[model samples]
Target: MFSDSTITENETRRDLPAHLEQLLRTICFRIRVQGREALKNYSITAAQFDLLQRVYFNGPQTMTKLSQSLGIAKSTTSGLVTRLVRDGFLDRRRDETDRRVFTVAITPLGEQVIKSVIEMRVRYVEEVIKQIPEEKITLVHNALDILYEVMSPKQH
Candidate 1:
């Protein structure tokens, strides 16, 4: 996230607004806390969930690739993957041509875990949104839509 920020000599609030950053940070913190509670029911840790999501959405990746993509040390990812493999949430396969090279992929159980977690999150958010004023709720929803558009990568 910090890598995405661009610092300029003559910085203005528009360059990077503190209030906006604070609001986003607070929301992210609350959501993460709620996510942890939801994930606990499935016995999934944040790191595992993150790895599962990456493999799920972007296909299988080599140990090196996954480590680089996650910006974590390979040893750490290796241990995490080892646990996931032992827990039946991931499959670690050695390459046929290169026995030393291995790729990690999510197992069926991992998909189910991710699905269940998403369902839990949806229900949790639904419950929270129910308590918010209808008008304000719509405003936040629209804001997210706009934010996504602004943040999304443009086509070449």
Candidate 2:
């Protein structure tokens, strides 16, 4: 037979997953909205920004590799690359050895866009951080650290 406290603890545990899911969804939606606003000044869609970000972080990649990383079809990736190339945000060059394969790299303009977007995001986060009480800041930081550690993909 469970005591009243025991039953309450079990009930809270059962509801925790739903609460966490809602919290994560809301946070992601808010961040994406902020990022979308930042992207508007560059006249780039969020999908285009994502492609540029992948190359910016991972270095140049072939169409196939970019598609795999972006989890989109190769044809779709090709279209994005074409537009970015036309807009001078990305440069595409055929592989010297392979001849047939092309690699896409982010141009200086693309890098600038990425930097500006990141700065905007940082400012937004800073505004939120400023609202938290000084005494609770450490607690909030530690909680975020723990959550990141737990949610991050594990390395083999």
Candidate 3:
């Protein structure tokens, strides 16, 4: 008998809602694996590097704002912030107006590194897109636009 895992064989046998779920799963897996491989020379994981880029672009941010923007828990955000600060990529300071509020900013070195990483990522994306046909690229762009419309958050 085959031992059951968290996702049972029966669950796997059942039809998925659409290919979208499988496609997304495959994309996530491939991207994560390849991204790690690409980041081997970097001291941080791809995700940590991505967080650093976000902070460089839009920081001097509070813990809550960072958490929200990064779609992570506040504790997780704090941990990331601590690690970045340790890496000399971030500076943490109390808000001048609010003693209770802590904010994080990217270091100058972090900005330069992040800019390079962003360029590398853009080049990688361009290379991937180069494999697709022009018509297909247009279709993909249109589909993404529709997807954005469908999935956009509703304003209160």
Full-model lDDT for every candidate: 0.83, 0.88, 0.76
Off by over 4 Å in 2: 1-7, 153-156
> TM-score of each candidate?
0.79, 0.86, 0.62
- If both were scored by TM-score, which would come out higher, candidate 1 or candidate 2? 2
Per-candidate Cα RMSD to the true structure, in Å, reads: 6.8, 3.4, 6.4
Q: What residue pairs clash in candidate 2, if any at all?
A: none
Candidate 1 global TM-score = 0.79
Poorest stretch of ten by lDDT in candidate 3: 31-40
**Model 3 lDDT per residue over 78-106, tens place:** 88888888988889999899999998888
TM-score of 2: 0.86
The model with the greatest TM-score is 2
* Root mean square deviation (Cα) for candidate 1: 6.8
Q: Give lDDT tens digits, candidate 2, residues 80-146.
A: 8899999989999988779998989999999998888888777777888899899999998999899
Ranking by TM-score: 2, 1, 3
RMSD score of candidate 2 (Å)? 3.4
Model 1 error, position 142 (Å): 1.6
Q: Is candidate 1 or 3 superior in TM-score?
A: 1
Compared with the true structure, the alpha-carbon lDDT of candidate 3 equals 0.76
Q: In candidate 1, what residue range of length 10 has the lowest lDDT sum?
A: 1-10
